[model samples]
Target chain A: MKAPRRGLAALAPFLWLGVFFAFPFLLVAKLSLSDTALAMPPYAPQIDWSKGLAGLAAFVRALDFETYARLVSDRLYISAYLSSLRFAAIGTGILLIVGYPIAYGMARCPPAARRALVMAVILPFWTSFLIRIYAWIAILKPEGLLNAALRALGLPALDILDTDVAVYVGLVYAYLPFMVLPLYAVLERQDHSLLEAAADLGCGPTEAFWRVTFPLSLPGVGAGALLCFIPMVGEFVIPDLLGGSKTLMLGKTIWTEFFANRDWPAASAVAIVLLATLVIPIVLYQRQQARILEAGR
Target chain B: MKRGPSFFNLASVVLGLAFLYLPIVLPVIYSFNASRLVTVWGGFSTRWYAALFQDEQMLDAVGVTLRVGFVSATLATLLGTFAAVALTRSGRFPGRTLFSGMIYAPLVMPEVILGLSLLLLFVAFGLPRGVWTVTVAHATMTLCYAAVVVQARLVGFDRTLEEAALDLGRTPLQAFLEVTLPNIAPAVAAAWMLAFTLSLDDLVIASFTSGPGSTTLPMRIYSQVRLGVSPEINAVSTLLIGLVATGVIAAYLVQQRRRATA
Candidate 1:
């Protein structure tokens, strides 16, 4: 109950997060500027703490921007960034088309049915995310179930696996719940009387929806879009498992640089660039979320 | 509840539910197929399930996964609850914006960067990448999810109960433990489950942070699926589904019972 103790309690989380979360960014930022080397820890020049702060300053000054310059010169990184944005944008668009109706339908369900419906929606989402994505491989691969079904139906077999289409399918499938849940939360809180009021003012049903319901759900749309888009932009597993070498995703490129080429500094530079691209949407998302939280209270 | 055409809403809900469940159901059904090929259904058999149990690598991965989930989730919940409490109760402070930014950033941070950065940090600290390292990495990541869940619950909470406790001469920590905790227990429990599920399902971060003895179940599954699917994957997926279903139903029943009593 004491003021000093409360301050310390609040300080505890700040300290924990600062050390674990913010400190990593600092390390990555430093690593991003370092040169790749064939030494023990793989990237150089080390902090050289034994030489003290002056030595640290010298090492920091020695760090080059070549890795960053490589990202600009190499068309691969640019295409990868563009391709990631395209996939994520396409994924978000499809999610809106698919998720909007589902959330709206659930919102319109009878109260007794709505709870059960919400539970059902959450059930699959609660299950393993990777397993769900894995399930798609069986349905989309050449010798997979989709082909088998097509053969049963006397139709041509299609090979769409290891393509951007499969990656999009996987992205939309995996992230649909993320889109639906936020949309549902916002839609469920809408006041029905607003629509009735619109009708009373001589507005038609569809007209009333666009004028009132849709506007009211804008926050939900923003929230859902950001939730899906942000992760889709940096998605690694879907592109790796489902997309082709031609797909050109930043996430895959970064992963390959680190794991396959064993170039930590270059990967760090790419990651920082990715962070730069995402910074705007992230700030917007935070503001939108804060608005929603305020509205909730 | 209807605000529009009944047919449209009904069709949309049905289609969405079908799309969600069909993929899950196919895997479950194929998991029991006796045929070697996944597409064909020869007969019902437990052969794959038997094989899954017999596979030593899978067993080892399962052991590592369970340990990581238990340790990481528990730590994440404790720390996250502390964070949630601090965030919700504290009015505002000098560095609140920076603090909140750090808290929320990881929610949308890319897995690759997070993994790489954490790995670098571990390396910097001269820590070995094994079960303990995996535990620390997971706890740090999952704590954000737990904080978000608990924070949502705390937002709608009425502070009067805690105020009354304070008025009755209970210390802040004591009141928080006795009064606020019992009230927010549901959210806290949900946070724990979310944290555990995230840790269990993770592949990318664990791939970066794990060393010799810490190949998780998802990592094992990923490596296997690359080679190609066998009945073994279906069997494992089925087992995971069963586990999740049991937990969900149990939680649902408890919630319903609590609502009834309340």
Candidate 2:
């Protein structure tokens, strides 16, 4: 009952996050409601601090949903939002297909090799992500290494860079470890006896895997998918670097609106909508993670 | 019924690794190219490295990045350790749900949203967007990661050691400093490094939060990369890759050795 010191300890983090983390969203929301203006901060509805309360009332009255209205009316915003979702879905699927076998192989490795294999998967992740994505630019560019190698082998040059195909390739390459690590965690801990039981009962390797191993790895698959999909939806670097100017992803859309157009209100509106779209899945993922932690405890 | 890996599994592992590593290896290899053209390798040389070191703007950006990384990582570690301890130790305070939500939300929040929101907040407060602002933003973003790493270690921690120290006539702070600190040192170190790298590698958030004269190395590299690939950028990228790879492998090996000893 008398733990004031502990209470203070708790208050420090709470205060920091409340101010820095949670409060900013309110600012974004407020900015989204305001109109664009040619000003220092590039948003309208400025309060006249000379007449404090009256000024505040006028500012509140100035607020409207005009930016959100524009977002709905604009075809570009709608397509960007849809395109972001489509890219995320396709990227997640590709990552799952490409990552599952590698994770399975890593999980099934001899105990001595498993740690090293996990490190191999994680090593690229720890390296600079921007550099890795930039690396793809080097490989996929016209007349780059891929084409150079193709020409050496007497094959026609592949023009994959600056295309949607290139974007998917970059996503898969950059986020493969994210997809694999969780899958490996679940698969590595699975009991081998179930597979053996299936084998003894006349299940083939593929059948045993599909029924016993794959079913149990569903949690990991979900985890990995959400991990990759959530970020891919708002990913700017991958698309901007590889997807060319024609790709209309929401993240890039927001950047152009904010930086190039200096329309902070519009950018904030797009960001708010993006958050609204992602809120449910984010909460679900958090709950799942909490459950996993509880189960571990 | 023990069996070696099937051909499907083995082949996938090889191909997957090749896919993951070739992009990175190619850049590092080409960094030493003597030709000005990235595609054509005239011969092997360290001329790009020499050019990279002499570039003042690149050096300035590097200095800014290192300073930002160190400051933000330290701040995040300190605050995040407090957050982690608060989450794990302090049972059921008011606003606990909200506090915990803030911690986890950043991990899932898009960088663009985070960056934009913070920029607006700084603007509202009339704070100049510069190195310190970027540092604050990075700390805010990275604290969640730091808290998670520390919280994982804390969850598995045996509290009895600290309790014993407390029972032996030490104050709570003293017990924490002497017993808990040593026990969680590795996790704290790991968290700091994670935050540092997250700050270092960030481009999107820093782009929004940064101002003129505070361009980070990633932003600098990005501008050049957007224009086109250059040998100097390759040299810088290779250096970053080497530095990070060495640090991570060393940390991982230390962790493995600690696990073995324990």
DockQ of each: 0.63, 0.68
lDDT of 2 at A44: 93
- The CAPRI quality class of candidate 1 comes to medium
CA error at residue B18 for candidate 2, angstroms: 1.7
- Those runs of model 2 whose alpha carbons end farther than 4 Å from true positions after fitting are A1-8, B252-262
TM-scores of all predicted structures: 0.97, 0.96
**What DockQ would you assign to candidate 2?**
0.68
Provide the lDDT at B30 for model 1. Answer: 88
Q: lDDT: which candidate is best? A: 2
Which pairs clash in the backbone of model 1? none
- True-vs-predicted CA distance for residue B216, candidate 2, Å: 0.6
